[model samples]
Target: MNQDLIQTFIEETEENLQVVEESLLDLEQAPADQELIDLVFRAMHSIKGGAGLVGFEEIGELAHYLENILEEIRQAANPKLPDDIFNLLFAGIDLIRQMIEDNDLTAKSVGRELTELKKAIKHYQLVTQEGSSDEQTIQQQTGQKYYKINLKFRETIFETGTDPLMLVLELEEVGTILASYLNREQVDDLFHLNPHLLLMNWTIFLESEQSLDKIEDIFIFVKEDNQIVIEEISEELEQWFSGGEETEKLLRKEEFISNVDLDQVLAKQEQIGESLFLQSKTTKEETGQADKQVRNLHKQKRTETIRVATDKLEGILNDIAELLIAQSRVKELATGIVGLDRSLQSEIVNSFQEVDKLIRRVQEEVMSASMIPIGDTFTRLKRMVRDIAAEKEKDVKLVISGEDTELDRKIIEQLADPLKHLVRNAVDHGVERPEQREKLGKPPTGTIELDAYHQEGSIIIEIVDDGRGIDKEAVLAKAKEKGMIEQESQLDDSEIYNLLFKPGFSTAQEVTDISGRGVGLDVVMSNIKDIRGNVEVFSEKNQGTKIKIKLPLTLAIIDGMIVRVGGERVVIPLNSIVEFIDASKQQIKQVEGKGLIVSIREQYIPCMALNELLQLEGSFNNLKEEPTGVLIILKDDQKQIAVQIDEVIGQEQVVIKNVKENMGQAEGIAGATILGDGNVALILDVPTLFKLAKRLKVG
Candidate 1:
């Protein structure tokens, strides 16, 4: 088999399995939903066929039995599968996923699990098929219809890695094969034939109680290029299965089977064999080269869509970022030509401007391409919540909204673990048990809501649970006992809640497998911050706890406001700045216990000198001494702050480069970007700066 075909099969199988898992979850909620049942059945059917075509016998066998169980549930008078059945189905999905990951199911433990699952499935089949008598009575009443299927596949069908015999075998699984014939008229002598070309056609008389739609779906992948005709035949033709001279005569008379000698054709096919002989005749390298050529040709024919690796897309984005920086440099150099003509300079400026616009458009499109809806990630969390709730013997329901909110694919990938941790924590630590909830005058079933929406050019995701909220005093006491904070430290509710993120910090009385090892939240905080996002917690004693995370739209580039603070040049994210204000010495005043405050429109917001926050030289020692400088008001959530800068150097889009790897983590800097003048400017992290300002007490 071709490597490309194997990879494509794996990718497609994984996607289909995800769909199956999601639909299975939905089916539990609406057990009698016909659409969901059929959705699952079809996905498993596709997986089974693909697995067989790829020669993954274990996957094919497992999917086949699972598909049989789904079919039983699908055809039942009441399509409500039992809880035990759903559990078995979910377990089967997990095994299939494991098989796909390992590419084989030969491991000792996996093989044992597979054997046990198959036995359980077989038991369910027998239990479900107790109604087969009624089904047979109904089929007798309606009379079975026979389908005459003629399959004339394209010569290049082999390149697609589809075995015509697999289609026949699948048909047999759905119903009884009354009669079958192979047409080998296109086959040449073994020495002269091309091994890659499919030359035979099949004529199958199938007696089935299935619909025409179901029969046609078997040929879905090949129907476009191949000649697949399915029509109901006379009931009398069913008698041709007796297999005698008269049966062959009848089949030939109907033009369903050619007059070729069956034995001779079988002998010729056996002589030519499958690709085994070809593989033995050619060197490994030659066969690989041929397979590559065939795969490339097949890829060219598939123009509707193609999957590109995510790393390749990332590489393209990075190259485009470099091009933008080069364009900026070119524009800067164009301004320095002392003896250039005015007309030439104007044309050069316009050309550069046009290129800049095109590059920006390309960047936007690439960024858009890299974004996917967060719904898939949200859907995956449903199983997590269900399993954990079941294990803890709690009744918890997860409500998800704003699933269509899109984020960068890279960010979404990195978000899965953190989101899983948070959701698990919500189920484990946040939500109270059913009895406890009822005693508190709350609903028996607790709810955890996962929401995402866009605000201020950023994505905000909230995991809110209406359960037992965080105990502020307990958290504070734990912090003091662990020496994470001073015993005399006076902290606000938010600060106390933030203590949960400290490493090895837990308020649980005992540890469990889910959480309570003091491991989850700190990892969540670290992962979120690695993507330059911020997480905050809000809780009320009996109300609930909400963990809100703010993330940038993309990690590659951002619109930044360039500012000069003393001798250092910095870029503040444009989305973080509220407005600019010019304040005099009197407008800036020192509060009793707070840092410097700037009065703007009757609102006194905490003010920090940019130079002091970043500890840059050549900056004013105090904002009161140089209150003449401009102040950029930055807002995060409900908190607002003012940072004093010497001057604003206008705004520009900059490509963010990670400086942490080279310089290690800095206090207030997110990353660094290269300016047009071949100089690097540090990108300011507004949220971190806010935290730093709160700790700085200036008089």
Candidate 2:
């Protein structure tokens, strides 16, 4: 019921789902690989840890069972993992995601699904462990712990502003702690970091002849509010006691310490310190600086890594921008001075430029720091490709390249689902089954190349499959049957191929349980377009199919041209502004009964009034005033419509702010930004406006 823990549960569940996705993908490809077994185990291990945090006992128990199966498989090197297990894991992951997102993945659904999976995994583990010695050894080693003293710090222990590190260090003095691991998995990259959360849970086998209350007495100062959990794992305690029997015999009832000659020991210590210091000084003086760092791993307290959030960075950049503006104003006034010296003015100019360059670099780096490599995502997909390929009876291998390519973290999150859809489509539809491909004289296994690289200030991800290429003829027939294409359509092969993206378009001869209803491709196209990306398909008769998706590097800020039409200003994305020209009276011609069109280099540029789109009033009665009016041309292949505006105010970097979700209408506007004068400018939605212009002209 605690909101903080609830939020943590959601975040942790998301990470678990990611693990499930990756693990399943791996299990599909290398079902018997020990590394994959470990991957799956780690996923379950983290899930169990998270479930314990929120007091979700059922979820925690289920995760423990999953972890057991994974660890068993890893130790035994089990080669034949069942399909049912992977399916159940996927289902669990989906259920968890739903539960977190909507709070609708009910406990009943979770318990039922988990119960089913637990039963299956237990049976499988029993079978696998019965014949495997390695599995038995692992089980015995893990089972040796009899007492599990789980000392969880109170939830308010953090928010009450108690120093968690002090508490952990304090616990160390209570007994001889055997082992400790910090649960740092929940720490994400966020700005304005306040380390007020207790994320560490201790599991220690203390050497003591004391009761649970005696142990709990150590936390007496804050015990009223803090958590002190003590569970006696008898079997584990027996193993620990048995292991230390020899040490007990060595123990003596004497206050005796290992006495040493202090003078001799001090001399040796001095000698060692002098040698190290001399080595450092000599190296630094002779070469460059000392080629070493002071590394003290013992005192290096394990703490979660913290990163600044994007909003904090944005605020910092904004301050820097204001500083730059002040600098610009100073430069402007200094130039306008009546008696300013030439040399002084030049010095100030150079200094201003230097400041400008440094500030810009810092801003860019602050932005770049938020970029996480795409490889992290691709690595997860390795498992997905594995399982899907198996289910389809296809021998498919996913070879990824340019994984180190980094994108904004926001971009990465949005990129995941679309990339998944593309890859799955490739596996389920494009990759031919092993037997079918061998019969065609092709290699038994198909290669699905997942490649990403930077080009034209954007990143391109491609899903290329070496199997039967898409049948253009079949696609055209399906389109005709679906009435998606007019009977008299003059569409080419590429155009026909694009018809696959039309909603509810499917040409599958037989429907499968997975994806034959053709819901995926349309979604892929829509998602790509949502991020202002484009997806193109290329297919040969018998070679293969390649679906390439190109996305902009970042969506936070954009260079846009502000233009006025009907006496109101609208901002156009600079990237989409292909060309701008002064509309000449002679060059302009009316398109029959349609709207105005201008001939520019043998291309007809359709024109729309900016004010009319947003319903703002303006006049263009005089052709002489309109002669100098700018025609801002935009093109997306789907349309080449130009908005006629009074004047182009040039380009400036504009930070995009979404009209807050589920709030007000942002119908004609993409987003809004503040101008240099602090005036709010609406970013025009080009695609929406383009569609609107066509509709109005036809009317």
Top of the candidates by TM-score = 1
- Give the local distance difference test score of model 2: 0.62
TM-score, model 2 to reference? 0.59
lDDT of 2 at 504: 89
Enumerate clash totals for all models, in the order shown. 0, 13
What's the lDDT for all of these models? 0.79, 0.62
> TM-score for every candidate vs. truth?
0.85, 0.59
Range of the 10 consecutive residues with the lowest summed lDDT in candidate 2: 280-289
Candidate 1 residues lying further than 4 Å off, grouped into runs, are 105-109, 127-145, 150-165, 179-203, 208-217, 220-229, 234-303, 338-344, 583-586, 697-699
Give me candidate 1's TM-score against the actual structure. 0.85
Residues 1-699, candidate 1: write the lDDT tens digits.
878888888998999999999999999999866667767877898898988877788888889888877866654545556677788989998998887797763334599899999999888667655754443211111345567798888889876667888888889866887557777777899899999998887887676766554577677667768989987654444234434454545555644356656544334323322312222111112211222222123322555666788888899999988987887787678877724656578788688778878888999998888899999999999999999999998999899999999999989998999999999999998999999999999998999999999998999999999989999999999899999998899998878988988888899898999988877788888888888888888998888999999999999999999999888889999989999887554477878787688777788888878888788887474676657678888988778988888899988889999887897767778899998899999999888777777767532
Off by over 4 Å in 2: 20-24, 27-43, 77-106, 129-304, 307-372, 375-387, 409-413, 518-520, 561-649, 657-699
